[model samples]
Target: MTRGKWVAGAVLSAAILVALVVAGVRIWDVHQMTSDWALWPKEVPSKVQFANRDYQCGANPMPNTHSLDGLTKQGKTAGGADIYSAAPGTQSGTATWIVIKTGQATYTCDLMGGP
Candidate 1:
């Protein structure tokens, strides 16, 4: 084989290897993100009423309950649930609970224990 042909083959092989590695990394990342959460027995409600306003949990962009209406991130539970305070200056009595599983986030007005 010509020297030029050999070099081209080597470059093509390297490119393929790099592409495979990148794809594998992305897949691993997705799996990690999804599997990191602990399982919750009950499904997250589609909508939660807080401060007399309904917030959708399953929407494309999850509500930023952590920073919305004076709600702040209290902390993460052992089961990987993110806890947020209710909106300030409102009669919302309970803290918000957020759990992520299978790459989707669900929210509730009650505190759900962590994994």
Candidate 2:
């Protein structure tokens, strides 16, 4: 190929590579953000929950209760967040609140599930 053709092909290839990388990064970021709990579970006494202090509950007052019974149970704990559920049971709907504290951070959320 001529010199000009070679240079054009190189530039095109570089652009395509950069585009692919940007796309991949965006996809990964979306997955990470959605998978982790941003707030629902509780709060940290020192720090607020993800820029949201409007719903800061001190602790998991009703820990044993099955908010959802069978559908899906979700909560925040120890600055971490989780969801739980039972199997082969009636759907009692979901509970509304769960909270946990760790050092300077808190995780809080409303759960829905259990008998």
Q: How far is candidate 1 from the true structure (C-alpha RMSD, Å)?
A: 11.1
Candidate 2 similarity to native, TM-score: 0.34
Q: What is the C-alpha lDDT of each candidate?
A: 0.44, 0.41
- Across residues 71-115, which tens digit of lDDT does each residue of candidate 2 receive? 443333333544333332444433343344334333444432321
Model 1 clash pairs are: 79-114, 79-115
TM-score of each: 0.37, 0.34
The best candidate in terms of lDDT = 1
Which parts of model 1 are misplaced by more than 4 Å? 35-70, 73-96, 99-115
- Backbone clash pairs in model 2 (N, Cα, C under 3 Å; residues 3+ apart or in different chains), count: 28
Q: How far is candidate 2 from the true structure (C-alpha RMSD, Å)?
A: 10.8
Model 1 Cα lDDT, one tens digit per residue, 2-112: 999999999999999999898777655543433222233123333333333333444233433233344565444333455455445554454444332322443544333
**Candidate 2 ranges beyond 4 A from true positions:** 36-115
State the displacement of the C-alpha of residue 106, model 2, in Å, after optimal TM-score superposition. Answer: 25
